[model samples]
Target: MPSAIRFSGVSRHYGNVKAVDGVDMDIAEGEFFAMLGPSGSGKTTSLRLIAGFEQPTAGDIHIFGHVAQGLPPYKRNVNTVFQDYALFPHLNVRDNVAYGLMVAGQAKAERYRSAERALDMVALGGYGDRKPSALSGGQRQRVALARALVNEPKALLLDEPLGALDLKLREQMQEELKSLQRSLGITFIFVTHDQGEALSMADRVAVFNEGRIVQTGTPEDIYYRPEVPFVADFVGSSNVLPPEIMRDIRGVDAYGALRPEAVRRCDAGHDAWVRNVSFLGASTRVSMQVHGVAMTMLLPRGAEIPAVGSTIQVCWQQDDLHVMSR
Candidate 1:
């Protein structure tokens, strides 16, 4: 399938700082692709480049097979939902959503119809007349989304769209946005610092660091078989042991990463002494000293929580170990 958005060797700079460096990506048509990273990792910069808000200092950008490099923001078939929603406070929900169409010189009836359909699509039906100040944060966000979707853009560019919402509302909107993308079948390029959000929503995620993409894969691929130590440690919590490769079987470094869950608590047989036990609601996180190195293990709920300073055997199968060079 032809990609809806593509970036080839894209880079952007602010004076001496390379905000986005050598990013190459292909966002498939109708795919929910997320760029995940920490602050200053260039995810937002990449999104801005795609939206034509910023021009790449090197390389090129293409949207639906057309070179999008020199095109202005409005000329590109993309709409952005920013962190603040960027709604017009003076306009009602309907008017805010209809503004884009109206600016494009669409007829009043056609603009209203498009706005109404978009509002309905976002479950904000009949909210056209409500002012932004009268709406909740989630509702305002919906209005922003409706405004973006009403244009029927080729792709939606989201830069931390849910960052302002509280945790519960953020999760709720995450689900709503994912469902909306699937229903609409439009490409989505989302930028976020939240690993959980990207893991939950993205069809495939590109992990960025210091202006470059470190890894790109499905959530499971990134979580279970991270190609680099940064990808493994950043994506989820894991016991990153600095063990020498004692063996290599089937291309896996046999003596490397051991997920906390993979190490089971056995009778005092293995060489480990428990140092601490943290209650994590559904499971207990056990920190232990193994061969003079600190390690952790996760025991399932209802399992006996080991006492601090107790001797316990921590055993893991070879397959559970993910070996990556430091």
Candidate 2:
């Protein structure tokens, strides 16, 4: 398969700061690829490089096998959907969607037709006459999406596009965005700090840290079988055990990682004292001190909730522990 975007040892330096340092990546055509990381981790900078908003200080970039180093954003077959929506308040939804075509000297009638189809694709067919202020946040987001789709971009770049929505609406839009990406069969490069969104929506994920990509793999691989302790700790706040804990628990000399949910309460297991308990409607999160180290585990809704300050025995599958070569 052709790569929708490729970065070969790309580095973007700002004299004293290295925003993107030697990033090598390949986003497959039609794949839902997620760049997951915290702020200052270089994920957003990577997206800007792909969007032609920034150029690499060193190395080459390719879009669908074409050299993209000297190309402008308008020359690339890609579009960016930013978190702000960036919609024009004065223009109607239809005209907003067709603005790109209008700038490219498209005919009024033809551009309107394309805008209508784009709006229909986002399930906003009848909202052509509505102003930006009249629509809800989610609706405005859809309008922004429709605007991007109007250009028929081969690869779409999303920079935390759902960051402004409420929890329920964000979750709903996550599903809708996934569905839209699948239907369009175009490359979708999503940049976000939300682990849940990346894990759920992406076919593959690249975890960024300190201006570098630490790991890239399927969600399960990134979650269950993390390469380093940082990936495990950042992705889901997994129990990142040091070398001492690893030797005490598993007779290993290296660092280790264990997911909270994998820790099971057992009567004849290692003794630990409950530090705190948090109810999350569907499950209970328990904080514990085991071997003088903090650990956390999620209990199902129907499971027994251990009171804080109580001693509990816990166990986990041997295979569930991921050993890291520190």
lDDT of each: 0.87, 0.93
Give the Cα RMSD of candidate 2. Answer: 1.4
For model 2, how does the per-residue alpha-carbon lDDT over 1-326 read when each residue is reduced to its tens digit? 88889999999999979999999999999999999999999999999999999999999999999999889998998998988999999999999999999999999999999999999998999899999999999999999999998898999999999999999999999999999999899999999999999999999999999999999999998998888888999996899888888888789888788999999899898889999999999999999998888999999889999999999999999998989755
Tens digit of lDDT per residue, candidate 1, span 36-129? 9999999999999988889999998889999999999989889999889999988888899999999999999999999999999888999999
**CA RMSD of all predictions:** 2.3, 1.4
Can you list the residue pairs that collide in candidate 1?
none
**Overall local distance difference test of candidate 2:** 0.93
Which pairs clash (backbone N, Cα, C closer than 3 Å) in model 2?
none
Specify the highest-TM-score model's number.
2
Q: What's the C-alpha lDDT at position 206 in model 2? A: 99
Each prediction's TM-score against the native? 0.93, 0.96
Q: How accurate is candidate 1 locally (lDDT)?
A: 0.87
